[model samples]
Every structure is written in structure tokens, then in C-alpha cells.
Target: MSKKVTGNAFDAKIFKRLMGFAARYKWQFIVSTISAILMSIVSVAKPILLQKIVMIYFENKDKEGLLNYSLLMILFLLAEVILQFLFIYIVNWMGQHIIKDIRIQLQKHMLQFKMSYFDNSSVGKLVTRLVSDTETIAQFFGQGLFMIISDLLKMFVVAIVMLWMNWKLAFIAFIILPILIYATKLFQIAIKSAFQEVRIQVANLNGFVQERVTGMNIVQLFNREKIEYENFIKINNKHKKAHVRTVWYYSIFFPIAEILSSIAVGLLVWYGSLDIVNEGITDAGQIIAFIMMSQMLFRPLRQIADKFNTLQMGMVAGDRVFEVLDTHSQIDKTGKVEAKDFKGNIAFKNVHFSYIEGEEVLKGISFNVNAGETVAIVGATGAGKSTIINLINRFYEINEGEICVDNQNIKQYTLKSLRKKIAVVLQDVFLFSDSIFNNIILSNETITLDEVKNAAKEIGIHEFIMSLPNNYHYNVKERGAMLSSGQRQLIAFLRAYVSKPSILILDEATSSIDSYSEKLIQQATDKITRHQTSIIIAHRLTTVKKADKIIVMDKGRIVEQGSHLELLHKNGYYKNLYDMQFASEVA
Candidate 1:
């Protein structure tokens, strides 16, 4: 989760990419930029107007001229304020819009990634990239990029005016500038590193907390509450230290900048007073204008240093976000063929797969199922039963061989088309935090409530559903936590059956349930699996006794295949499994 800061203090490539998100709002960006320029120009004008009011009006005893010029100075102040407000508002507005677009694109991209990409990545870290990192990039525009530009513009205009008014005094005032600039450069580099570490710590803390909260039940069940608390304290401490490092740089850099700024003002007054007394070339008004401009020049330079850190932090976040965007882990979707009027015939040819290199979960195994056939795959834990389901769904890429549905290679059909023809009921059924009706339909407008009710009636779950308060309209809550395990399984069966998939897979669908729920599920299963191409995976051999054919597996390889009686006669792996399960049931 802790990514290294390989980039420089400022990466031009990342900056340009971030700007591309603003293409739709170019007019607003232009207005903000123009306002910054105008604000700088107006800011420089006020100091000049003040100098004129002192020298031309007050010096000559012209009260009316002094009052008029003072009003003009007030008018310029008002214009500057208006421009500053416009600059701040527009830049922030654009920032929020840009980040909204980025987050949308990031989420859409993640949705397309292969399951293996998620298998190897952290959920909490992805959440940080999608939410926290994108927010930091928003500040890149609001506080970093445009604010730095505006401050630098003010400094530039003030510098030109200072020199134009009186070059000798301007040179004297600029004597300490080089030292401040050097100090600022050092601060930028140091703070950039510190901010990168801070971001890493934030991601780590988020990951730790998210995992802990999600698994709080497991922690409480195992009496790990105190241990988890201590672990949290350790991660929280690292987060604090990372932030304190950033503060450390701020504490050192700011006071040094203030000292240098005070020195610049002191030099301007010392030389200006000597000039007025010795040669009568400088007046009180000129000295006062130079002092104001000196503050203007030094203040923005210091502020620019601070803003540059914000810019650096944005770049760090941008780099992490773009790294995800740049990944080429999405499943290939170039297949143009549609699986219309699909047949239930399925075949696997010399298939081989490994979740990790050199450790195959499925060897070069091959099998075939005729249309409308019902087959069962029985295996011990880690025998690649679930991996076969994943492969059939194209959730991952195969390392070797091909899978064919309806006698055509699955790769020849679009992923959407291929998956649309198949339905799966997982052991751990996942229902959204929504009404039961919506969860069953899953946003498919084509399936009406009448159809869902009909499917439930045929599956024998209609009475069970109607018994609940609000019936089908009841909210299941997150992951269907409001319902029992058996209840969730019943919902999944209805969902898959209503889809009318050509191929149906029930992986351990009847395991770990009460007898009442199992009886209901068996009734539902008989209705859905009848005359449909169905593959069942179960540890319960008794459930597969009626399967037309059963494949027994151990340690990622098939050891036997036949009907229950045929395997029992052979006295092989399947018979031993059936005997052991029957003995356990009797006990």
C-alpha cells in the first residue's frame, strides 16, 4: 500500500494529464486565469496611486487632488478584491468538476479489471485511490496550480514596478531575495519527500482500519479485541509521525522566510533614508511605495513555497491514481460474436491453470457434457472446484487450452454474451442492501415482478417469502445480513432461475443449512436443474446421488468418474467418499 515517490518535486507529464480533465471547462479556466492576471495588475496599480497621492497632491497642499486620488486608490482596491474573489471561486469550481470526472473514470476502469487484479490488490487501498487520492488532486487546481500562478504574477508585476520607480533602491531591496529563493527551493524538495511519506501512511492507516472494521465479527468471535486495538495504535502512531515530519519542515522554513523578508524591508528603508538626506533624490512617498512593494515581492515568494508543497502532494496522489488507470489488467472484450440461442453443450480441452506460477490448480484435464445433461464435480478443499467455475465465467485468463460452449470457443463470443447464457448460485450468496424484489430482478427492466413471483412459486419459495413482513419488498440490508444463510440461498435460487440461463451452476448450494431450509432448497434445485445444463459442486455426496454423472477429484486432479452406484461398485475415490459421508450421517 505504501508506494514510493519515484517522481520529481514537479512532474510536467502528470500536470498536463490533470489539465486534460479541465478540457470540458476551458472557458471557466480561462476566466480564472485572466482574473489572476487582472488582480496582479490592479494590485501593482494601488501602490503607484498611493505614491502619486503623496508626491503630487499632498506635497503641493492640494486637498481636493489628495481626496480624489485617495478615492481612486479605494476604487483600485475594490477591483483587486473583486478579481481575487472571481479567481478563487472559479478555480475551486473547476477543481471539483475535474475530480468528479476522475473518480468516475477510475471506478469504471476498476470495474473492467480481471478478477486476478483484485485478488492481488487490497480493497482498502483501492478505496483510498478512488476517494482520498482524487480529492488531493482537486487541491492541485484549487490551492496549488492557480494560486501559485497568481502569487507569482503578483511578484512579477511588483518586481517590474519596484525597478521602474527607482532602480538603485530596487537593487538594494532585492539583495536578500537570492537567499530566500534558495531556502524556498530547499524547503520544496524536503517537504515533497515528507508529503509522499504522509500519503503512504494515510493509505496504510485506511487499509488497516477498513479490514479491521469489516472483520470485526471475526475479531470479536476470537477474542482479538485488545490485540486489534494495540495493532491499531501502532499504525495510528506511524500516521501521526508521517504528518509531524511535514510539520517539522514547515516550522523550520517559515521563520527563516520571515527573517529574510524583514531584512529586505530594513535594507530598503536604510538606503532610502540615506539617499533623501545626502542627495535629495528619494522622498518619503517613494520610500513608502518601495516598502509596500518589498512586502508584496517577499510575501508571495514565501506563499508560493507553501503552495508548491500542495502541488507536490497533488502530483504524488496523481501518480498513484494514474498508476491504476495505466494498468492493462482488464479482460479482453474484442470478440464480436454474440451467443444467441445458445445450446447447453460444454467442453474443456486440455485445460491448465495456475493462480500462481508453477503451481497449477487444474492440470491438462478434459471433459464434455451433452446438451441438457446434469453433471456433478465433487472434490476436497483446494481441489480446483471453484477455480473451474471462475474459468467458465471468464473471471480470469487461462494459461493453456480452450473452453467451448455450444461447440464454439468461448473466446469467440463477447464476455457479456457468454456470461448472459450462464447463471451461478454461489455458496455465500451476496445480496445488495436493497429490497428483496430489486435484488431478485437485479435492475433488469425486462423481468417483471409477476415473472419473479411466478419463478418463486415454481421453486416453492413463494410461501416462505410471503411470510416475512413486507414480503418481497423487505430490505435485506448489507450482504443480506438481516436474513438467515438459508434465506439468502433461497433468494439466489430465484434470481438465477428467473434469468433462465442455458447453463446453471450451483456450487455447494445445499451445504451448511438447516433441514427445513435444505428441503426447500432441494425442491427449488429439482425445479431449476430439470431439463437444464447444470453442473453441481458439493462436499455432500448424498446430494449428488441423483446426478447423471459425477467427477471425483483430489489434489487438483480427477481420480474417478461415474454414477453413484457405478463408482460404488468400482470401490474407488467416489465410493470411499460416499461411504465415509454415509457413516458420518448415521453417527
Candidate 2:
């Protein structure tokens, strides 16, 4: 869930950090800023030129002077147009380049985070941070900061000119200024809250839609379409309300600004006419210039309020993005040892672990597997069978205990080097939406097509793959949905075999396949595990009977460890489990 933004609408620290991304393109940023200032200075020249033409040329009927000043005003207008274009183009270019760098850095950081971080984080919210929030930050440069600076500069220059021309009329013009400024301040505060709510609703709406679409199959199977639709309606309604609240603020603020601007103009005209008649203090040309200056000053004051909201939204987005970047969930990769020629010997000594703090998942368990030995673990659900597989790979840090490989602590080896020596084929296989060959090689470039075909042939699934539409080039679609479950399992076996890892783990690899695929998997299994250290976690008792040794677990502890025949004869936990399966098969 997103936290509410508190304190000031403008966060200086976050703004500075966001600007740091622009340091690489400092030249472009500087050019844009200079262009914006030039544009503002150019904007003030038109009113001053009008005042000069009216005062000097109109009274004297100097046609040459009038023509010269008119031409000069045209030149300034053209210069302002060119400066405006440069300012917009350069700032937007800088924004795009900065966001690109930030996105790359953010993704790289996220890739190194620990698995536990992902286990608790929402995928949709992470997507929001990566895609939408970063885009908003980009607007901070393109539309918010530079534009506001230009508007404020224009207002400042116009205000100074107004006071210099006629002090009394300028004072009348600014009488309504304080009221407008206070109202703008109130509107900014109110709209900032509204924009924050809008952002939150957008994230919620994204998260809900993503989850529902990914689980559409389950929704259809369970007849939950109507219920889910109703839930979606509720979320969508809240999103609408949040946006309407922002619109409501806009609707109220702009009209008040327009009315106040009109009142400032009216006050200027009344005071200037009275001063001209009673004291002959001001002329028509000065009054006209002051009126123009009043508009120039108040226009940006109104626009600044709008631009300030844009700035505020960007700050909100920056806060959310930095929150993700600031997370300290990365795995420690300080181990310097490289497992160049890792042996497959493994040991677990009194290991303790838990996903949650208070509840223990693997409690004080000890086990060992000799080099090049094939071991099978059999147990019911939640018996810590798969947790052992996760521990060996260092997916999660253990609470208390030592896991050693090759008589040295696994922590001594770099994570990349250690994982490279181990290959896992899980029960629920996942394949990318790509060709069979690419999925097998996983874009490694080091593994050739010939190598993959040879591995498939060694696993005895080459002929099966050849029968597919495109052979090794067949596209499996997302999650291998185009292939049968058994076919996916065969592909997984080939993938693991091609890696040539020192240790191979098959967790229920044959659990849900047909008899033909199971036979093929068994042949592949025997071929691959013959000279490799392998761990097989299976529910089928028949598959483990020929294993060199079987470890039976119950509730996170090793209840029995022996050969299949020895455990069957002992009439222990393994005996009861084997008899129950045998009875079910006979019935």
C-alpha cells in the first residue's frame, strides 16, 4: 500500500535527488533554463514598446519612429517564439533521457533483491513504480520546474515595470493581489491532496486489473465473473471520485482567479482616471501600459498555481519511486570465493528456518548427500521437502544452522557461481513465450543449438520434439500453455540436462504426467542422474524404490532414512506410507 504524503507539498531532498539524474545532460539542462529566462525577458519587451510608441510617437506624429518601434516589436516577438521552442524541446529531451537512465538503474537494483522481498511485494505496484511513476517524474522536468520558473520571472519583471511607471496606479492594480495569492495557496494545498488520492486510486485500479486478468481462468472456472465485476465496479467508482475531486478544485479555483484579475483591471482604470483628472499625475499611455503590465503579472500568478500542481504531482511520484529504490531488501553478495570446480557433496547441520518470524518451517534438521549419489526424499505436503531444495540454493537465509557444500560453507561461494553449478526442475515448470531452443538455452549464447539437440537426444525426447510443429523452434507461448503438461516436463528435463550442473534437483518432476511421458522421464532421469549428485522429491513410491537411499520426512524432520526394502521390512513410517499406496493401487 502507498503511504500518504505528509508535510510540505514540495520535498526539497527528493527534488534534488531527481535533478541529480540530469547531471549527465547538464549542458542541455542549462541551455533550456537560459532559453526560458530569455523567453521571459522577451515577453516583457512588448508592453514597454507599446508604451514608448504611444507616449513619444503618437503625440508628435513621428511616422519614422512609430515604424521603427513596430518593426522592433516584431523582431522581439519572433525571438520569443524561437526561444520558447528551444526551451520546450531541450527540456523534454533531457526529461526522456533522464527517465531512461533512472528506469535502467531501478530495474537493475530490483533484480538483485532477495526472493523474500518479492514474496511480500505486489507485482502490480512494482510495475506502477517502474512505468507510471517514472513517467510522472519526467514531467517534473519537462512541464513543471522550467515552466514555473519562466512564469515567475515574467511576473517579477512586469511587477517592477508597473511600479516604475506609476506608483499609485500600480498600488491599485496590486490591491487584489494579496487576496488572489492567498486563494491560490489554498487551492494548491487542496489540489495536492486530491492529486495524491488520484495516484493511489490509479495504483489500486492497476493492481486489481492485473491480478484479475492473470487469474481469468480461475475466475471462469469458479463462476466468479459477476462477483469480480462488481468488485471492479467499486474500485473504478473510487477512481472516478478521486479524479472528480481534483476537477472540483480546478472548477472552483480558475473562475475565482479570472474574477480577481478583472477586478484588478477595474481598480487600475478607476484610480488612473481619477488621478489624471484631479492632479494630472498620470497619462493615457502610462495607464494603458500599467493595465497591460497588470495582466502580465496576474496571468502567471494564475498559471503558477496550475504549474505548482504539476510540480506537486511529480514530487508525489518521486516519493513513491524513491521508496522502492530506497528499500534494503537486496541479498548480500559479499562472498568472494568462485566455485570453479565445485564438487556435489552437500550437508545440512541443525538448520532452522521460517518464512514468518514466529512459525518455524524447518526445525533443527540435519542431512547429508555424498558426492555423485542419487537420493530420494518422500513425504506428504508441508513436510519441508521443497524447503530443503530452496535452502541448498540459498534462496532464503536460514535462521540458525550451517549448510555446507564440498566441506566448505555454501556462503563462502559467490551466489552466481554456486547457482551455476546447480540446476533445478520444479514440479510446476515455467517456460518463456519463445522458441523451445531459446527456452532451453535461456539466451545464454554460450549454449549452441547443436548442444541443445544433443541433450534432447541424450534424454530420449529428441524424436518427441521433432514431431512438434517447428521442432526445436516451436513457440510455447506464455508459460508453455501451447504444450501439454507432460511435454513441458520433458522440455524442462532437457533444459536441466544441457546445463551440465554438478547437482540436479527434480521436485515431483513426474507427478502429473501420463504413463508414456513418465516412462520417457524415467529414462531421461536414469541417463542424467547416473553419474551426477541428484535429489528427487517424489510422491510416487514406485519411483524411489530403486534410489540408492530414501529419506522419509514428517513435519519438517527426518523420520526414517534407509534403503526402500530395508524401510519396508522395518514397519516404520515409510512402511505405513508404502502400504497405504499399495492398498490404494490394488483397490
Candidate 3:
């Protein structure tokens, strides 16, 4: 992905995109804004009320007037607290709702992306976009946007009150304002760069951890633990350094802001004392009120810097997320034809394809499978065996081809309906962390537990399932880690069988299993493929001997294709492969 040239904390384009999520909860935001304004007004009134009570009622020994003024102050303070609560609650509510909607839309968009996108993208990075990045956008709404507005309002109101009370004192109090603003601007620029680095490191760390943990078994088997640990430490330290840089910026900024705030207060006292002694223009009550107002003004100046950081981080996150949302790699499913009446007749005419440009995996390969025909494709590694099945499912668009089903172009069929009628069982079967029943039926209401049990019986894996402690309700754990490879393959078979697909494609389905499991899988395969158009890709010649037709592929082209007996009699590529395998087994 290309780097986004972000402007500032108030980057209008990025912030506007973020507010699109907020606009959905405009009423709540409006309420929160009103609450913030009310709090600001109440806060501004309290200090002025203090000045009045001190200058008039307390100084005159007017007990009744002082009591009434104190009561009014108490009421306004109470109102301030209530409004603050509402502002916080409503802002956070809006933030959560906005993030929920964003996360849902982000995931929905990713789900529509083609398999080619996933092939080139990092799963961990995508996951971070869905979870951590979206949470940062939430912070924009909950803490950054509204709180900045409220703080600015409070400062603006305080400035007006201070100027109205004593213009000369207000001028003295604001002596440090320009310096503070300059410091804030510098802090914003420094921290923006630091925060961008921090987010990049965070994504890198997440990707590293996810990949290493997922492949832990391979690392351990290859004895790469020490090397991998050293690499992880390096990534973790980079992540730590990125965060420490941000903290360093905060450390420098907050202390400077505090010193400026103190200087402003000291300036007020020093200048006000001079005005009172030399000119008698200001009194003790007005000076005290000016002190309070200065704090109100400068403190928000300090806080606005922090809130601005929050807003900046949120924009950075939004930029990354919007990149995913804006990706247009989704496979087109706008075909007018539905697969409701699919006949399972598939053909690939002069099909040419490549994952990367100019490196064709399948070079103008042409073949056809008539209705209910069982065709097995055999090839060495990287000969485009799996690519064919992927193409048939429309996981990746072909570079140049006419893939047709029942004399109609496959591209003319809606993807969902087309895929629903076809089922694929890959060599590496993946099961969710759910019960075996859910894994088989995939939470489909149409297939019941009893139906799954019946399908398991039909595939001869019913006894194996019943042998487990929880029977069909047993959780398979992540990727079916709790089960043996053969057992997982058995579940895959059962899943495909339950779908009742018009076309079944099994890619090396029984190649990695033991003889016992292979026997069971063969029986299941025979039952499932009976009278159904099945495409099987396998390396084991024994498995495909029973196939109706076997096609031998070499270097992205078919070397020979015929029935098992016919190919053997011809002594071509298929015969050579079968003879080599049979001899190796005998030896």
C-alpha cells in the first residue's frame, strides 16, 4: 500500500470520513455538544459569581446577600457536574456505536474481497484493522472531538469573562498565550510523526507474533526457537522504542505547558498588584477571579494538545482502515444466471491463468467434464493442479479463458448460487472452533444434528464421532487441532457430503493419510462421487485407478488423458507414472 500524505490533526478529508460514522448518531452527538456547552457556561459563571460574592456581599458584611450568592453558586456547580456526566456518557455511547458500525462494515467489505487479495495480504494486519484500528477511531469520537470542542468553548468563554472583568488584567494573563500556542504546534508536529511510527511498529509486531505463533510447530520441529526468539525481541524492542518516543514527546510537552500555565498565573498576580497599588483600578476579588479565569483558559490550552494527539492517532487508524474498505478486488457476482438448475457440466476452453503477471500456472489448458463424470487430474507439484479447482470456484479470475457450465459461461452464473452447488475438500482441511455438528452443518438450519449423524454414517465416520466423549457435540478446537489429520479429513468429507453438491472437487484428499484412513476415505469418496461430476486431484496413482478418466499433467499441459486401462495399454505418461509408483511400492 502507498503511504497516505496526512496533513494535520484537523485533516478535513480524514476527519470528514470519520464523522460519517458519527453522523449516524447525530442526535446523540448534538445532545453531547449541548451538554458540553452547558457545562462550559456553568463553569464560566462560577468564577464570576465568586468575584461578585467577594466584592459586594462578603466585603460589605451582607450576610443575606452572601447566603443567596452561595446558594446560586452551589446550584450552578451541581448543574455543571450533571452536564459533564451527560457529555461523557453520550460521547462514549456515540463512539461505541460508531466503531461497531465501522467494524461491521469493514469486515463485510473484507469478506467480499477475492482470494487473490488474501493471498497477497497479511492476515494479522487485516485483523488489526478490524479490531485495534477501529478502536482508535472510536477514541476520536469519545475523547478527542467533543472534549476538544468543550475545552475550546470553556477557554473562549473564560477569555470573554476575563476581558469583561478587567481588560488590563486579561492582557497580562495572556502574555504566555502565543508561546503556549507555538509549543503546542511544535508538539503536534513531532508527535504526529512519532505516532505514525508507533502505529506502523504496532502492526508489524502484531503480524510477527501472529505468524510466529501460528507456525510454532514448524519452528519447533526445525529447531528455530532461538533464532525466532531473537527476531521477536527485535520487533518487540522496535515497538517499545516507538511508544517511548511518543512518551518522550508527552513528557517534554506537558511540563512546558505546566510551567507556562504557572507563569501566566504569576504574571496575573504580579501585574494586578501593580494596577491595584499604583492606579487602584483592580481589587482583590477581581484579581482572584482573574486567577481562576486564567487557569480555566490555560488548562484547556494544555488539554487541547493531548486531545489533538488522540484525534491524530484516530485519523492515522482511519486512513489504514479506509484503505481496506476502498479496495475493489471483490469477485463480480452480477451474473444473471443462478445455479438453481445447474447440470454439473464443466469445461475449460483454452484457459490461460497466472497468479502473477507473465508467469502462467495454467497455459491454455483445455478440458471438459460431462454431467456426472468422474475425472481425476494428476501432476507433480506446481503443475497447476489446485489452480484448476480454484478457477472452477471463481476464487481467482482467469487471465484468459472460457469456463462454462452446461454450455453457459461460468462468469454468467451468480457466484453464491454457483458455489453453493459445488463443494471442495482441500488437503489441509480447516475447521472452526466449534462442535463437530456445527462444523459439519456450518450452523445451517436446514441440516439438523440427526441429518449430520446420518451423513456421518453414510461416510462410515459415525462410529468414530460416537467414540468421542461429546459425540457429535464435541468441540474440534482451532483448525481441528484436537483431531488427527485423517479424522479431520473425515470431517471434511462429511461436510462436503452434507452439502449434496452437484460437483465435488477433492485436491489430494487422501494423499497424506494412513492406509486405514485412506480405506475409509476411499469408501466415502466412492459413495459421494457416485453419479455426481467429481474432479479429483491426487498424487497417489492407486487412488485414481478407479476414476473414470485420468489426466496426466506436466509443466502446465496435459501429457495424456484416458481411462485407467486405456492409458495403461497406451503406455504413455499415465502408464509411466503408475508403473513407477507400483514398482516403488513393491520395493
Candidate 4:
């Protein structure tokens, strides 16, 4: 990926967060910095020590001086090796620990975001952000931080050694140094953008592949394999182009940087030898030191180039990571409101709501249900039936007015505490890939097997579990794909029962099941709702016939609401709906 991203994606705050998190490990970081300083000085000391050995010990033919110098150099190198190890180990450990904290915070923040955010984002992209992108950010802390420190220290040490050798030649060599640094930085920005494009294309490709593969059966049934393949090819080509662009940038960068450094080193050598011959004041020691100075300066200059390259990568990955970190989730529980008791009495007061603006789904909705009441919501598809229950559950905030639980406005309660009191078994049942017993009990490490069996039995799924080869210990496949739709729904019902909630909500809970399973569900519903406040949203008119209060809604408004017998007597919308279904069954 290119090192430089567009100015649009650049976020100073994200950079601050990244650096600040690493800064938390102050002691380890301080130690690493000290080690770099010591190492840089010791490194330069090697050449200085060599110079002294040659001039004083070797020239004078003093064997004792040579032996002492050799022993001291060995000791210095050993200490340097140990310090190098400590620097690497401390930095690595701190970076990983900081990353763990960041990941946890990112997860918590993402979970709080509104469901609408997810509707527009692909699950594959989100997964990549959480798992891969976060790791990239952590890597900047571990590798990038240490490299920058070592490079800068080496550069400073080289400058000092160069000044001590021949100040005039040293000054001339570094004249183009600022320009080289600036050019690399500019190239780094370009590289960052290239990498960002690559990441985006790759992320989109992943999303396309994941969704297409998961629904491969549908694609094959429709005979659209060729069409899907073409779509895949388009994204794949885009990714390839992005990678190629990055390569091209580096091709230009490395060569230009190499030429500049080479030219500087060539000048240093030519002038140093000329000055030695012409002035007669420059000695062999001076020439050797000048050569050493040339190497020291050029070496780190090359490394600084590579450091900027790594920085570009961090910028690209950081942009993607910050995108997720910046998102605001839906569940806002910042209010300090606490709800101690909800008596299962839910009321919607002048509630006005809409999934989209100026297209209200529940307009001026008003209703009240006392504790232990069974109220059924009957409406045609898109008649705002599900919206009613969603409002009561506080899944979506109403545009205007209040929804109260036990006369306390839901907004007045903390989201965590309020949601815990309600249980819902939706039509789209989702089961984890776990044993049947765990699926039912869900959190029964302490709860007994009898409780799991009792809940399953309540939903008439106990016998089925016992019949399984390993019973509750049997592992389920993804999405409970191994189980029948009815079986999955029954497990969902048992899961809700395990919560022991005051309010029970079933939004078309039995829509996909066979007749026998429907009867089993109906039987379970009857017993479960014996004394609980229940809300059933369904299209089957017969299911709500025995309800004490049956509400009929249409076009975002409740047209008629009364007992089933009362609506039938009036021969209104509900009566017509029931009669039409009854006539179709009879035919």
C-alpha cells in the first residue's frame, strides 16, 4: 500500500490516541530511549577506540596496550548486546498490552452504535476492522516506535563524529540532506494514499466474496455464476492496480534516494584525499575518520528513508482503524436513570415514529396494557405492526412522545437494566453453534440440567433433545443449519423463557413452521402467557381471536381496536381480514 493517504482521511486525534496509548508505558519507553543513547555512543566509540589502538599501541609496538584495548572493546560490546535485548523486549510487551486495551474499548464502542450504522456497513468490512486493522495499529507501536528512535539517535551520533573528523567536508556532504528528507516525506504521503486505496479495495473484495459464497446456492439456482464472476473480477482488478501503483512509487523513491546519498559520499571521498595530499596537515587518521564519517551519515540516511516508508503504511492502516473508532453507535446509555421495578404495564403515549423521515410508520400511536394482560397486535404487512413491539422494547426511539413501562418512561431507565426485563422471540431465530442444552439454557454453567429440560419441555422440545445422539452435548453447526426451522424456533422460545422476563414479545414467532410445530408453539404460548403481559405481532388472524384486546392497525394508524368478538360484530377491517382467511381455508 502507498504510504501517503489523502488529506481528507488524515485525523490528528487518531494519531494522538495512538501515540498516547503507547505513552502509557512510560517506564519501559524511557528505558528503551536510554538504551538507544548508550548504544549510539558505544557504536561511535568502536571506531575511536580502533583509532587509538592503531596510533598509540600498534605504532609504538606496545603489546600490553593492544591487549587492554581489545579486552575493553569486548566488554563494551557485550553490555551493548544486553541493552539491545532489554529495549526490544520491553517495547514489544508494552505495545501488545496497549493494543489489548484499545481492542476492548473499540468493541464496546462499536456495540453501542445504532443498528442503522451496520445496515450501511458490510459485516466483512467490520470484521476486518476489528481483527486486522487494529493489529496494524498495534504494529506501529511495536516496530515503528523503536525504529524511529534508533534511526534518529544514530543520525545524531554520526553528525557528532563527522564534526570531530573534518567539519568542512561534513558540512558539504549534508547540504542536500534536508532536500532528501523532504522528498522522502512527500513520497511517503503518496505511498500512504496508494495503500489506503489498496485496503479499501481489498476490504470491499472481501465483503463481496463473503456474501456471494454464503449465498452460493441462491446464485447457482438463479444461474448467475458468470455474472458474479465478472463482479469479482472488477474488484480484483482494482486491487491489482492499487498494488502496482505502490510499486511504481517505490521504484522512483528508492533509486532517487540512492543516487542522492551516493553523490554525497563520492564528494566526501574525492575532497578528503585531495586535501590530505595538498595541505600535508591531513593525516592517515584524518582520512580514515572521514571515510567512517561518510559511512555513518549515509547509512542512517538510507534507514531514515525506510522509516518514512514504514510511516506511510501506518498512516494507511491508521485511517481505516480510525474510521471505526470514530463511528457513533445507536445504544446511548449515558443517562444516569435507573429503573428498579417494571410491572409489565407498557403504554405508548402519542408515540410518533418513522424508520425514514416524513414517512411515518407509527403515527400518533396510543395504547395501554396493564400487568398480566394478553394483547394481540394484528395488522397487514407494512401496517406498522412490528414497529409497535420494537417501540415497547426500546429498540428504536420514537420521533415524538413517550413509551412507558410501568408508568415510567423508558428513556428514564438505563438501557442495560431496561432491556434485561423484557424477553423477545423474533421470527428470525438465530442459534449459536453449541450444544442443544447450552442453546436453550444459554448461561447455565451454574443452572441445573433439570432447568434446561424444564424450559425445553415447556416449549415441547424436550423429547427431541433426548432423542439426539449426544443430547445437550451435541455440537450444532453455524446458524443451527443442522436443525429444522421449527426446531430452531422452539429453541429460541426456550431461550427467552430462560430469561424469566416480565414482558414477553413474539413478533411473528411461528410464521415459518409446519402445522404440528405451530400447535406445539401455540400450546407453549398459552402456558407461558398465563399470567404474563404478552404482545403478539402476527398475520394469522386466528391466533389473536381469544385475546382480551385485539388491535388492528393500517397505514401507520390503529383503525380499529377491540375484542375479537366486538370487531367481528362491527364487520370492520379485522372482520374482513378474518372472513377472507376463513373463506380461503374452507375452500
Highest-TM-score candidate: 3
Candidate 1, run of 10 with poorest lDDT: 1-10
lDDT for residue 15 in candidate 1, whole number 0-100: 83
Q: Against the hidden reference, what TM-scores do the models get?
A: 0.92, 0.91, 0.94, 0.88
Separate clash counts for every candidate: 0, 0, 0, 16
Model 2 Cα shift for residue 222 (angstroms): 4.2
For 1-587, candidate 1 gives per-residue lDDT tens digits of 65553334578899889988998998998899899999989999987888888887647978888899899999999998899889999999998999999999999999999999999998877998999889999999999999988998898889898889999889998899999999988887778778777877987887789788989999999999999999999999999999999899999999999999888888889999999899767887888899888889988888786688788779878999999999999888888899986778899898999988899999987888878878999877898888889999899989999999988888889999899989999999999999999999899999998999998888788998899889999999999999999999989988998998989998998886778888877887787778889999976655687788888888878888888789889988877777776556744
User: How much is the lDDT of residue 543 in candidate 3?
Assistant: 61
Off by over 4 Å in 3: 1-7, 200-208, 218-239, 585-587
For model 4, residues 1-587, the per-residue Cα lDDT tens digits are 44334323334766677777777788888888898888888777766666667666536877888888878878888877887787777777876887787788778878887765776787866877787767776666666657677867877887888777668877867886887877777776777678667777987887789889999999999999999999999989998999999899889987887788777767766776788679745555555655566566666665554565455455556777777888765765665677655678988888899877788888898988889888988877899988887777667778898888888888878987787778898999988898877776777576678887887777787888888879878777788988999888888888788777788999999889888888888888888888889898865655687677988899889899899889889888988888876446433
Q: Evaluate residue 2 in candidate 4 and report its C-alpha lDDT on the 0 to 100 scale.
A: 40
Please state the error at residue 472 of candidate 4 in Å: 1.9
- Residue-wise C-alpha lDDT for candidate 2, range 144-200, written one tens digit per residue: 888888888888877887788777888888889999999988887788788778877
* Residue-level lDDT for 557 in candidate 2: 88
Q: What digit string (tens of lDDT, one per residue) describes model 3 on residues 59-133? A: 698888889999999999999989999999999999899999999999899999989999999877798899988
- Residue 429 of model 4: what lDDT? 93
TM value for model 2: 0.91
**Ranking 2 against 4 by lDDT, winner:** 2
Q: Model 4 Cα displacement at 304 (Å)?
A: 3.4
Candidate 3 local distance difference test against the native = 0.88
